[model samples]
Target: MPDTPHLAAQPALSIFYQLLQFRDQRRKGGGMEAIATTLTEQDMRDIAAHYATLPAPAPQTGGDAQKIARGQQIAQQQYCSSCHGAQLQGQKHVPRLSGQSHAYFVTQLRNLRSGARADMDGTMASAARSLTDEEIEAMAAYARSLP
Candidate 1:
């Protein structure tokens, strides 16, 4: 069962939770480790293949229109559209910002600003550094409004 009621709403997170459990099991150095090591290379490859085949997540379409409009303006001013698509759909290694939960999005932005997040090539860190909490909140709101 999900640890929290909200967690049950995000079924996709089960994959990450399972991965963390697998890592913890390996670290414990006992029966769990044995099970972790039992996965054949082919099995790992198949898992990766399946992940690659998963469909792209649908863009989010739920938010207050006023908040979304404000966020859009903030994103443009912040140059977020330069890296994330103009629609916040993401590109290459950059993650899609659209459809992410507002809480999760805000937390990531805060982490980036605080230097707690390890971003590729330091671009996100630099971008985040210039954001005030209000801007971060606006960005999250805007990103979650895309569809």
Candidate 2:
């Protein structure tokens, strides 16, 4: 199984929306549905707020240089920063991509590409559509290397 996402320092709005999706059965996996189903709106909000106040996850190291570079190139070409922020730290409703676990990132990307994941506005699905398996791996490598 892929690792759970590191939610610390993620935007509260993003977390809140994701929780709503899980609670409503829009986004599935990681047993979040079961957990979210028990949360009231206020409970979700408080959870989001709490996670947002925590520090970001530490940067991962030892990624392949070439793969990271290719991923950076792909990210730029994809205009990821337009919604994700300059450093991929995420915007109001965009989850932070930096410092994500490689396995988790790749799985989510694959899920988005396969239409198995729920994209809030279809943007993530659109963005992920053209990515090849190699590209996804490289992108995950890049994301894991960020601080």
Candidate 3:
């Protein structure tokens, strides 16, 4: 099974937006739809706030150096930080990428690329459109290696 995302330290607005998407069936849920449906708007807001107050997850260790380097290069080339924040810590409705689970990140990227996932804006889809599978893997490795 894929690793679940560590919601701690994520932007509250981002979490709330995702919850709304899941609730509205605008995004692919993978079981989140039912849970989201049970939440009132206030419940979603409270959940987002609670998670945002928690400490961020620690970075994964022992990643391949080459992959990390390539991922960093790709991220810079793609200007990922322009929206995700300088250290990928995220802001407002944008999600934090630092320390995200590799499997989940990879899956999301692929889904974005293929239009299998719904993005609030087309930016993520556009950004992901040209990525090769290798680049996706490298990006995931880089994100996981962050502190």
Give candidate 2 misplaced runs (Cα > 4 Å): none
Better of 1 and 3 by TM-score: 3
Error of 2 at 26 (Å): 0.6
Query: Across residues 36-135, which tens digit of lDDT does each residue of candidate 1 receive?
Result: 4666655544554464356554556756777788889988887899988888766554566776667768876887788775554678899889888887
lDDT of each: 0.62, 0.90, 0.91
Q: What is the lDDT of residue 86 in candidate 1?
A: 84
Q: How far in Å is the alpha carbon of 134 misplaced in model 3? A: 0.5
lDDT of candidate 2 over 1-147, digit per residue (tens): 357999998999999999999999999998999999999999999999999999998887878999999989988999886888777889899999998878899999999999999698898999999999999999888887887
List runs of model 1 lying over 4 Å from the truth: 1-62
Error of 2 at 95 (Å): 0.5
> TM-score for every candidate vs. truth?
0.64, 0.96, 0.96
Write model 3 residue lDDT over 52-137, tens digit each, in one string.
99999899899999999999999899988789887788899999999998888998989999999979989999999999999999
